[model samples]
Target chain A: MGVVMAVPRHVACVMDGNGRWAALRSLPRTAGHEAAEAAVMDVIEAARSSGVTWLSLYAFSTENWRRPAVEVDVLMRLVRRAIRKHAPVLHARGVRCRFLGMSDPRIPAPLVRDVADLMTLTRDNRRMTLTVAFDHGGRRDIVEAARSLIRSALPADQVTEASFAEHLPYSDTPDVDLVIRTSGEQRISNFMLWQVAYAEWIFPQVLWPDFRATHFRECLDAYRRRRRRFGDVGRTATTTGEGPR
Target chain B: MSRTTPQESADVFGPDSILRRLVGQARWALPVVRATLLEAAHPQIGAALMEHSTFLTHPWRRLRNTATSARRILDPDPRVRDREVVRLNRLHARMSGTDAQGRPYDATDRDARAWVVATLFESTVTMCRLGGEVLDADAMRRLYDEHRTFLALIDGGSDRLPATLPEFWPYYDHVVEHRLENNEAVGVILYRLLADVPAPPALRARPELWVMGRSVAGPLATAIIVASLPESFSRRVALPDLPGARTLMRSTYLAAALATRYLPESLTRVETFMGLAGAGADPWASVRRQAGKAAALVRLLTPAAEDDGETVRSADRFFAEVLDQTGDGYLRWPDLAAMAREVATRLDLGEHDEERLFQAYAAWWRELQTALDGDGDGRVTRHEYAAAAASLPGSGLIKVADVLFDVTDADDDGAIDADEYHNLFRTAFQRDLADGGGTSYSRGAFVRQFVSFMSGQQHSSAYASLLSQA
Candidate 1:
């Protein structure tokens, strides 16, 4: 509606190079994750400052499980930490916390609780939704939605594109208006498939750990520089909507 | 502690994430863990509890006392009777909100759970010891449902389900666990019926209400539920193995009613997030019980709800009978797709000019094809999917919720709760399926759901005329 609404209905970020970021600094990958957590604060605040409402950050990925056992352990630990670590700030900032892949209760019950608690605390906060996609696969979300609809007692022909949103992981997290993939990755890597369809893509070369408010602002500047068009009749080539990468 | 201190706030975070560590440990060591948390905060939990009447209430007091008691059992040598006391106390503590580790309860803390599974022998003996409490229509119903474990059977073999079933969804036969096989391709027609009913019911009639956690179902809906109750709260519902479930429909019915009320307690109960654990689970239990207690109070203090044996039109009953298993091939998924395409094409609405037709049936078909990455027999056909999309009330803007369902079905389990639902949508919509090519409309099951959703709205409106007197 206004710049207030221009705050990306959805924003996805590819938090890349955690290991490399750690390795370059001669620290444990966990340290990098820890550093990344700090960076998360920076990006999130900057996004909120820019009037972006929903920020979907790509933290741990489904493929990340392929990493060394030690690394995976550290990541899971980091995940648990991140969940508890951000509570007060989340409550203060009026941001809700949700993880895309970790739904089952068996998936580190404590971490799950923390994530859930944070979300519960900020459930009423309309400021913005900061979604952390952990071990989430974009393709999986699409298929899952299909399957869920199929199982519902609700009728089939009744299903529609807009209707499906009610069943998604980040159902209320707005449409992706700008995508910023750190470490210069051009691919969305199966981040948000359905919601990001029309989001504008921006690739920043800076490694994730090095990324800061300045870089975040740069992305916003870039986002402001472009125009968004959701495949309609009038707008043709230049402008596109924003979404998180 | 006045206004704000960024550094102290930060103290609770990072790799130095004390809260996280505390939460993780709380599951295993509740008391010390909780005390640690309350200690970290100003003015400990015991003190906090003293300040709030919500804690002094029966349930909270029992919960608090048990937690304190359990901390005693940790010692090596406790008398046999006292040890027995420990077990009984655990049960009492749980109801009070204390964590399993005998720590103070923080309803908001995700990791803490006041688990106290009561043993059968003790509970049975306990029931015999304490006389039951019964009040009026609502109270009796509430207590009956919450307490009655054994139910006597009458005509039907299974008394588990309500005698009178819902009409439109006859496919709900407890069939094949999660898989319901309707010989008739009811999915297609049902979807259509759901999408565009001649006159849909008001929103309140539906179990899962809209955004604000409320169902605007009219008074008629209540009357309908009331009508279904066997008119006798003591009807027997025998279970095959475990003690027959309490015939007490009061608790269950009230849960549904409370859900319809749109209260915060109901919000905690219905909202998908955090629903599985802690206070979030059965958050509405208290609300329903309170309503029951209020009903009891009213019987003592004022006029209770009066039910006239006078003849009332059995509209819901008639609809239920007519709605069930008509099985005629009235509408199909393909028909819906065609309709969606027609509508989208007519509207000429799209986010970008090129994608204007993207919301159409053809676009839906392509999108579905792409999502499948493989072809299937009844997969959402481009036309079928688009029809669903174009059918939803929204014009051009993509419903973020719809996009969520288009993703997130890892194993095809069929249904996703709110949390899982949100995760899937976030992944797909945010990721844009990798290259950011706009998501297609054929993944439009959500649109169909929306169509039927309007029916609840209609039903609620119908009920409004009758209930306004209350």
Candidate 2:
């Protein structure tokens, strides 16, 4: 069948299998992480070209702190270097940069400053918003949102789904429409729980380091073919409008 | 992040999340059937079916169609999933008729629509509860909100819908108390369905099968249905509280849940119904088989060739003759085997075809056994056979026409007006004949086309030509 695409406004990705990719090539995991930068660039270009307004990448999770201290250090340094190296290019391409997740002290002070600076620098860009979720947990985000709501002393009846969403870290970003996870992992792993309530999920076999613009396009095409019901019935062209009750 | 966030995390449940797993794991088939019966209890819908639906004549077909629609509603793609709701809305838009009391009925009636949504909600909750999941007030609220969101998609908006879960209860209770009726249509349909509990081959061939089966199974089926219903609704429907039966059902559900928990995800998940919607193995293969058996039974029972002195002319006559030979309603395997041999000999089967003919006979008996046997117990009782026999005479062609006309006649004026006719054509063929410019046929011409189509003559040339172009 021909691809009749309906591009989602926002696409979130769980980039997995970097360690596996490095292991497969008999290289250090750091090399795999470094290689993933190219894939990220390619995906950003693809998202911009495909009319995607928001691209949220699961770059780091709260659980990542459990890794070896050396690996964690290497990852933090890699994140800082990637931002510094690619900020100019991303800004040039009119991509707005934002950091998501908790403002924990565990995420080095200098890295946090760099993230703030980069976000400030690219705040006015219009082409796309790239949200790198470092030290993020979906559960954590919800907790923070609830805390904010409590702090504001909102009335009990005022806590609607729309209202509750506003307290999240990235309130400006819309809910995720598509969540793509690489290396064939099917589970959500607690990523963007609230945002991906109705999102279409696609799990491809390619590792994070190998995922390219072509793979991204393929995922989008696959998404286009799906019929998103939103828990409602399907309608066809011949359907007649029902009279009001 | 200081081990974890200091603030408490709220659990998020979505379509692809754990909530789907909960729904998937639950044994929903029985609850769904119970829900459908409850929905049909509503006077308007019951009356609508009595007048315009072929459900009684083609029960399995109607059920399969409903299952297909339900599967589409759960489809992953929002675009494809919403089509069934749209179709229902469009169909309902044109649906208007009179009830048994001569009161006008419209599908868009707010109360009628609300009752339908209530049935869906109650059934899902009932199923989840039966599957050993107890919802707290907050969880129930969330579920209610989710269903409201779903209803909004169907009803176009939530203006007429209740604002909160608590507010919905009284409205639902009121509907159940007053609006639902123990109408003839619902009673007859439910009785027939209950009576036709398919049994195994051993029980099916028994003499006076239906008499014995109905005696034992009929009351049991009624008790189960009663037990499944809410207490107030049960009383309204004049069904006694079957406490013992309810206990049995609970135990059965508990056992089912335990077994399902151990089973693979592929087995528990209600993916697609008959491979109609999603990519997966057809989970309803048995239902499809039953439908095929019902169709064959209808064909065989219909009067075909003229009766000869020796040769069987119709399935009804053949079965009667076999029953006479046995001197009881029960027909043992040996009796059926003998009958098969005799029929084969009468047909003068060639030596090479004899084995194949016997195999066919065996296969037919097996299919009949499967279709009649509601319980997997190898023995089929008389009631099971009677139930299968009851469905033999298919809904006649005229009844089908009546149903079609009832649906197509938007104004219920006994005639299909030009606009209604075009609407019917578009709905049936999924094409707009007037797209080229104006309707090529007049009202009379369109009526002629319908007549020709109903009579099994050549269909409308315009329709045929249009279909060919696509």
Candidate 3:
């Protein structure tokens, strides 16, 4: 079937395999995270060129809690160092930086400084938005949304698939259209909850540090091949036919 | 020989200088050099009468060269002009104060650095919050630069924060549209990105299932999550278009930009909201400088609480439904996750409570679907209730009689009862404030006197005020 080049308005990626990527090169795992951070600048610029308004990257997950505390601490410090170093480029380009994750009480104290510091520094950027999903869990997001609604006193029958989305953690962002998980991982690993219900998923073999914008484009190309069906008939199904996949 | 002069050295450096020259050729650099000195105290600021033992002036070209080199490599953006100003103030503070990082001679200098941090955070946050209204990237970058520079004040003085946060106090304000680095815990970013997956719209009526989305959806869900707690009317106004205003758009956008370059401490919400704000600086320490980070509790004049601590729940479920519906729209706004985090801080809500509130929030959504899913011919649709079922909030809210509800003759043909309005009105006056904080009717010192006129009087009066403002 013929496909439409429907690039996602909002694109999200899981920057995975930093440790493995570093180890494979006979380097410290910390090097991998650093490399991945360095790589972010190029990809970000590329994304802007492509006109993607919102880019969400999976930097850390709630499940990552199982790792050794020291490694985590190192990563947190690296994040600060990278931000301190790369922030000028981001600011000049007009890119706004924030993240998706558990609120402060859930995240540790040492890292909170960098988080808070970064948030305050770049509050007025406009070129593009980059959201880092750190220490985030999908199920927790849904539950939180549900809880928010109950406190508001909404009635029983009024609840719908659409009603609940209003309360989720990312309620302020748009629905995701495509998601790319790096480091050869085939799994989605619990990311966006309500926002990416119908998002197309792609798993690339390259680790986050090595993944380039061209690779990102390839993923978008793959997403472009599918016929999205929002539990309804595809547009082609009803019409004379742009055909089907 | 390197254009180093003893006189200039005496002017800028502390008393411990090992070497000094008589004079040199590049002494013309004083204009720029003098500005830096002015920024710091004249070894003394406005009100101060005393002088420090270590105070001294030093060479300008070398420091200027260092600053230029640093900005060239680490800070190439002009948008962060406020950051430059803050850095200048901080250095100024350190020069005047005794306890700067390098100054061993003067450790007793009153902590002026704290004020610099505090002001920097407040000004930057306010600037970003307001600039986000237009969704201008340039403006956002500028504010973010200011945020980052203020962070140098004293990140290690973490102990200076409020010894302890207030118990049971709700948080609602926070920075937004930025990304924070998680260097310490390699994988750990910030608390802003906690959820495993994005929360999706749930099936109507069964709101309890929402709590389990992470576990329930698992690998099938995208592996990124973020949320916002509740924010107030003022935040919404910060953007444009709400009642169509964009001011209330998204915090993630604001947080993300700033996170990449924020007042480092403010983005993360350390021991206190942030350490640098210098909120409790000595009253005597004052500087004529630009406002830094501007953090303030959102002030709203809500309805007054009753004398009996009874809150009158509004019978306008329709308005509540609209609020819920509008909230759903929040999911699609630009940087909502950061906005959610901001709301959490603004509300001072715990993640657990935020989750519960969301559950309650989802449960309350039931009434909206029923209204929206009407027949094409305008026939009303009704959801059945057993009547004997318990009315606990967690279970589900019952759409009962509003004071102005129209009860139809269901006996003749299963219609609503007209007296439901009076029942709803009565119920409004007799609501139970389940949360321990206080009765829904109890107004914390925050409520203004003028708004108190309509408390417990008429629901329409509150609506009238809102409408009048709109």
Candidate 4:
């Protein structure tokens, strides 16, 4: 059967199971982190090539600070190195780079400078936007947004869902159409608090380090196969409005 | 069985009417789920639900709301019934949306509205049949006519509905075969029904009992739902073939038949309609009082006489179904050990958690043996085990509840929030039935209500009211 495939406008990836992947290989967790840089670059390249307008990656949660200091240190170092390596290639490809939650002061000043420089360097590159959520919490984002709104002295009655959404960071990012969480875990882990109201989630069993462009394309195909209702009646035919009963 | 006269049939709420009798059955819940599924199978209705309804998220609340709406429409007072119908019509009138294919759907569409009512008539009939109430052709015709009358009362249009039972069959079959789509909504509803039925909170507190009930009733409910669907539709939907499904369906039919035939209406019928059906005496209270008197007499006759309580009978059944995994008609050490392992596995516990569960179960078993092993045979008979059930909850058995509760309290905040509680059941039994989403309260209070329900401290009606609100 011939079928038309629809491409998702915004796709997010919850890069999970790195620890498990590393443990499985009997390597230090840093090895898994190092391996994941290839998957990240592959997904970004594949998504842009596939006509996706926006892509977000969940790199670290706000709760990751609770992890042992050594693992956290390794992750911080790995992220800075990956950014330095990929910044020029990403800018050349016309991809806008963004860092979502670098509010914590523990992040090294030099690494922060490197990230800010990349963001400024790619500010005008609009072929696609890549949002990396580092030390991010979905609930905390909402709370911070609410604080911003309160600080603005906006009237309570005027705070519609749309208006409240405007106060959120990166408000231009459209609602996520597809979320791919690798390694088969189903929990949201607080990714994209305000934007994924009706996102279609695909949890593939492959670990983050092993997830490739083929798997990414497979997820896209799966997303096409799904019928997104968006809290309305499913459109089943070519028939338009028949008007009143 | 006595035949209903036309005069009695006209009054659908009359005690002897088929509508009254069928709606009164506690098994009415079966038809409600089936009817909801069938309605959602319609592409337009399913779309409207996605847009305007929370059926996907809060189905338990939706079911209770649907039941409430039905009860209001069937209220004994004409004014109340008319008012409810008007309110419903207004609510439905406001619902309009575009489908995925961009086909505009007005919820007030006559055919769609009529189909909704038709599903109720058809599903209730199927429910009655599956529940062992014989609905022959004549009875079906009578019921159909009454339903038509009901439709006219609610929608003020019976013209869109089939006029006769024979006509209804063709119309129903055509819709089932041609119009119904195995859409996303239908798939979700069916999947949740079959795979996600959670044990009630009381059962959750008792892991072994939860498994026992889950193993049987979960599959049985799913079987009845799949069996009730026409074979062509079932095949078209590509529902998985359940092993022993035929046997389960037949067993359900036979059990329902016997219950309807032998059990008093008070036991067989739903509690909501008891007073409206003009019940004379409170049968539950009367039974309780008589049981109390009998227990007193037994105590006077013999100082060593045991309670022989309802709890004990329940325990007796639990002993057989859950604790006695070997099915040797005795409770042995191996049985307790197996139960501990089963509970741990069902809960998806790690080795450390499993060991804790094992220790608790072993302690409880030793307590049972010390108190109830009359013959010193290193085994407890059903009677001896049951005799100690009255006191079992206070013994080491409570540790099991504690373990289950602790496992459920995900954050270890000493209180299981709604999500944690729901997650526990979804983790253990694939899904949960207690629509804890709508209610905001600690799990402790919910468990207490369930306990009161099981021990019969709270009246069935009271428990039902609490559950419906929950």
Candidate 5:
């Protein structure tokens, strides 16, 4: 008999090392991004099938605009193409798509429209929600939330953590339970600061382009093996729920 | 016994001192978690942290704040350092709370602060020794003495911490062996270090370098922390262990020491000299200040229609007379939903169109509540509604208007006709009026509401005329 494991409700991924993967293969960075399409689809299918309710992918960061203009152009086009290609598949699988942090003017209008269309098409999907954080910066999101609150003319004393959280983008999105940053580079790089405050993290050493469903499942297994205490004492035989300190 | 002069105080960690020589190297950060664990092991410190700190929710942030405070204290500029001392004192003054056992804990307590300083001093030596950058007995003693002086600066008085290297060890050992509690704080940190070790944000962009070092960094740091713990301490607490962890630590720290020797200061030091470039100084502070000034100037030059008292009143009246169909003092989701249903009924719309109108109103309510619902009571007061309405011209709520228009304009036309507009007003002013049976509002009222919704133009006369019609 096997012990039942508690699966995380929401899992977020920072898909890193695409450029590094391309460099390793002596191919253009675009090739690595192109290859990541398979990994994204695979992860989505895996998460949907494995009973995960919410999955967020770090598709592009605000700082990614600092890359060479040519590469940025290619990435924007590639992302649009990927969205167009995956919309039907995602909708059919009942995966609701939401684009977070889409405030950047550099994002093409047509791509924005396409994203809106995708969101509307998948609006009623209840199986899973796939939030793609494009042009997102955690710091920027926080600043925007603050700005929005100020514009609302809310009294200072009335602002609580719960109220402040409601001002953030996708306020309905639940806190992330697990954050997997591929390529074994263990930096958060300003992704979802408020959401991932207490999230467990996994760095898998594999570049995102090469990540597969097996790796995803392995990470989920690792998550189950670990215990989450959230500041309280854990349940152990040697120690009562309350200890000396 | 005598007070040290300013010159004498400056001599601690001064030029040619071993403490200064070893302090800021990037590799020193390796034992930071270990030092933190040691500090938390002290019962008072652990109890205080558990009571007052957001350590569980924001562990790295807590660590960063500590680092920032330390950096400011160690800043070469006297003004910066002194300012930080004052800040630290002020901050510690308020950090008093009770632990789970109802024992009061004060962060400013001498023994707890002393224990914190002790861990820092001991961890520095351990970090140096493990990495093969050996410090002699004299250097260790000198460093310990320097740390005592450092403590005096922070404590704002003579050092009450253990005065000498010999005295410090027994004090440290006794606490580690006996007094240290097998608490959850240490367990959580150790678990995090082993399972979710994150690189500092400073190293975020250096993926290749981090990847090369990550395999060793997390496990090695955990191993060092575990190994550094005394057998009694480890036994008392459920300290985690790794197979061959010590071997891994030895090899990696040796390589790291070699790298430190060969690498440039930029690669080896986490922080450089204190100046404008220091981490304590935000590089964008000046830019942000200038931008703020520019924004203020723009506001000054722009039209003041948005801030007009009449505009606020107009919005207030609209909330009371239009959206508050229940004649209640507060507007809630049901009011908005009912308004949408009324508009659908007035138009004699199909079920699908009715649902669309309801969804639009819900979306609008969500946007408004997300922005303006300060107390989050699920009800928007007339004042809150009016305040939000005053700023509606260019805000995201304006986008909500577009959504509402799209849903309500069922004919696929770009605009709503007078009949459609009347339907909206009829739903809005559904509350029983004293005059009764006269639902038709003047064209001035219609134009005024339209301008507020579409163009957001504020006119006192228009509002007065609209109020007369209402």
Candidate 6:
């Protein structure tokens, strides 16, 4: 009999090496971006089937804006097209779509509008949540939460970790339990810092465009084998019981 | 013989020392289990286990607790070792109960104590043998002597322990033949311990290997147990002596030891084991120190009560009420001195307990001189103290309010609200506050005191002054 695997409740993926993948193929960078769409879809399907409630895709980082203006513009356009093309499929699959990160003025107005509309349309989907982080930075998110707390006029003594967490955008999603960073990047890259304090990390060598359902499953299997101690001295979960509360 | 200094004693049990290497190796697991089973076979110990242990309900936790205690006993820190001695003493004091056959059992009984010591000696030898690290006659004698010294330190006396390794063998043989039994409780606990063995990572990665691993684990564990047992005891337990089981067990342990020698220290050394071992440069000590600092910060920020109604008492009322319990409503020097000594002892100041108590008394004396010694003659009569102490104002007891505000503010915005205070207190002091009562804080009282203290309008009352100075 196959051993039962403990799937993480939330999985965050840092899709990396698209540019490197394109360079290696002697193809335009846009091809790498285009190919990543299929990988994203495959992972989403895999995660949903594997009982992962939340999947976050690091599609665009706040630091990416500092790249060539043309690349940044093309990336923004590609993001909008991906949202428009995938929204119907995501909705049909009972997947909720949400965008995380700063709502900066630099992002084109039409793309922002489409993101909001797609989120609102799939707001009720409960099977799984697919969060696409555009222009996101973990430090920025923390700073924004602090600003929100200050603006709320809540009493200082009453503010707590839970209360401050509520101020973060998309506060309904739980902490990321497993983070898969493709392209062999070991560092977190300042993504979901507060939410992934004890999350198991898998740094797969495959580029984002080459990642598939099988690779995603392999990452899940790897995560299942991790003994997440959370700064304590034992395995966080057993094979047959709920994990540590 | 000259008295051994703490450093010299620590050197004998250091991380790289043979004793630690033997005890910490993965090959010792089977032998440790064998020892545990043997110890439980004693009727008094079995009765104690039946009464006091929760091995049936929380087997893993019970096992981990036992391992932690063992680690503490072997810890390098004199303070930690002394604390474990006290803890074991208290535990031994409580281990008295009637057996299943209506015979009264006591772990402190002469026979039971001897059996316990024998189990220890037997386990050490068995572990060395199984690990393929055979000790010669002199080495065996030295190991036994060291253990005897340890037994004396923890158990208070070694009168019941055998005088030498040669003498111990007969006692061990007699116990294995006459005293050891296949008690149902012991069997069940042994089964649980074996069943919970974590699968090797290579096997865990493959479904077929995982199943195969599970299927073989039971017999392999049983064979290890059988191999470690003496011939007569194996016959008594109905475990037929397989022709090559002993050799197989030794070879398996030897291979494991070889693998461990080649693997990275980080992978080979169990982090929990290392942390509990209290060896050189404990990482958990830093974690614990940070936790303690965080707890102190939380306590500083959290108000004593959750509502304005009962949170704040008139300074005079609080002093009078608290002092009345100390003695007769008036604070006395002798009472303060006694309180200081008690606090020092409770805090485990170790050999410096008297020094700490003296410091506490001196600090309180200084505070008293500043607040109530109006004559400046270094002594204040009761009339002089009572007259001067009435006007003393009460401030928040702990002084880290500003630092706590900065830490909890989250945004570094200068002004902190009730939410920041509540969250910081909960996160930093969850364990302490859980034991204190609940996490709720009196926002009104906290804010009032904090604001007054910050603005320099609040002063330390006599009671607050004494505690703060201490």
Error of 6 at B65 (Å): 2.6
Q: Write the per-residue lDDT of candidate 1 for residues B82-191, one digit (tens) a residue.
A: 44333432322322343223546442221111011111111222222221222344533332222111111110121232222131023222211222122111222122
Model 5, B1-470: lDDT tens digits are 32222232343456665655555665665666678788787777877665445444333434544555666566666666666676566546646766667778788998788788888887787777877776888888778777776677778654566666777788888878877787756876676545444333333223444566877666666776687665677888867667786776667667767878997876666553221111233433443344433333233233333223644565666665455544346777655654554344335455455556666667777877887777899788877766666555443334445544555455555545445544443223321111111223333333334446432343223222222111
lDDT of 4 by residue, A85-145 (tens): 7776887798999888887767765566567666756776799999999888888778767
The C-alpha interface RMSD of every prediction is 16.7, 33.7, 13.1, 32.7, 21.4, 22.7
Docking class of 6: incorrect
TM-score of each: 0.37, 0.38, 0.36, 0.38, 0.41, 0.43
Residues B147-187 of candidate 3: C-alpha lDDT, one tens digit per residue:
23323222323222222223101211221111111121111
What is the overall TM-score of model 2 with all chains considered together?
0.38
Which segments of candidate 3 are over 4 A away from where they belong? Answer: A1-5, A102-110, A227-245, B1-470
Give the TM-score (0 to 1) of chain B in model 5: 0.54
**What CAPRI grade goes to candidate 2?**
incorrect
lDDT of each: 0.42, 0.61, 0.40, 0.67, 0.66, 0.61
* Candidate 5 off by > 4 Å: A1-245, B1-12, B197-221, B272-470
B208: Cα error in model 4, Å: 9.5
Candidate 1's TM-score reads 0.37
**Model 3 iRMS:** 13.1
The residue ranges of model 6 lying beyond 4 angstroms of the native Cα positions read A1-129, A132-245, B1-17, B108-110, B190-212, B260-262, B272-470
lDDT of 5 at A243: 28
lDDT of 6 by residue, A1-245 (tens): 11332778899999998999999999988778888888998999999998988999998888888888887877877777777677667877999887887366688755665676676567767999989888888887788678667656689999999998887777787888789999998887889878887676789999999999999999887776553432244443433223442
Candidate 4 per-residue C-alpha lDDT over B1-470 given as tens digits, one digit per residue, 9 for 90 to 100:
11222222234454455775666566677777778788888887877664555344334434544665676666666665666676566556646868777879777777777788789898877767666667888888777776776677766758878777767789989998998888767876777544554433222223444467767766677777777777878888887667787667667666766776788866777663332221223444443334433332232223222223744455554554445544457877655654453344234455456667767777878877888899999898988866655554444666655665676565777766556644443221111112211223245544554444332333223233222211
> Candidate 6 lDDT, tens digit per residue, B1-470?
21222332453354544555555555555556677778887778877666555444333334444555666667777667777667556446645767778979875676676677577668767766665666998777777766665666565666667776667788788888998887755766556545544332212223344456667886787677768777787778676578888887778766766766787665555443444322224445554444433333233233323223321343444343333222233454433443343233223234343344445445655666677767676555545554655454323212223333334354555644445533432122221101111222333434455444322334323223222211
lDDT tens readout by residue for model 2, A1-245: 12222787899999999999999999998888988888998999999999999999999888888988888888887887777677677877999988777355567644664675576567767889998887888997887678667655689997999988887766788878789999998888878888888677889999999999999999987766553331135443112223111
User: Among these predicted structures, which one has the highest TM-score?
Assistant: 6
10 residues in a row with least lDDT, candidate 4 chain B: B428-437
Judge candidate 4 at residue A197 and give its lDDT: 72
lDDT tens digits, residue span A37-126, model 1:
878889889888877778888887677777787877667667766655556676678776666776432344345545555555555567
Superior by TM-score: candidate 2 or candidate 6 = 6
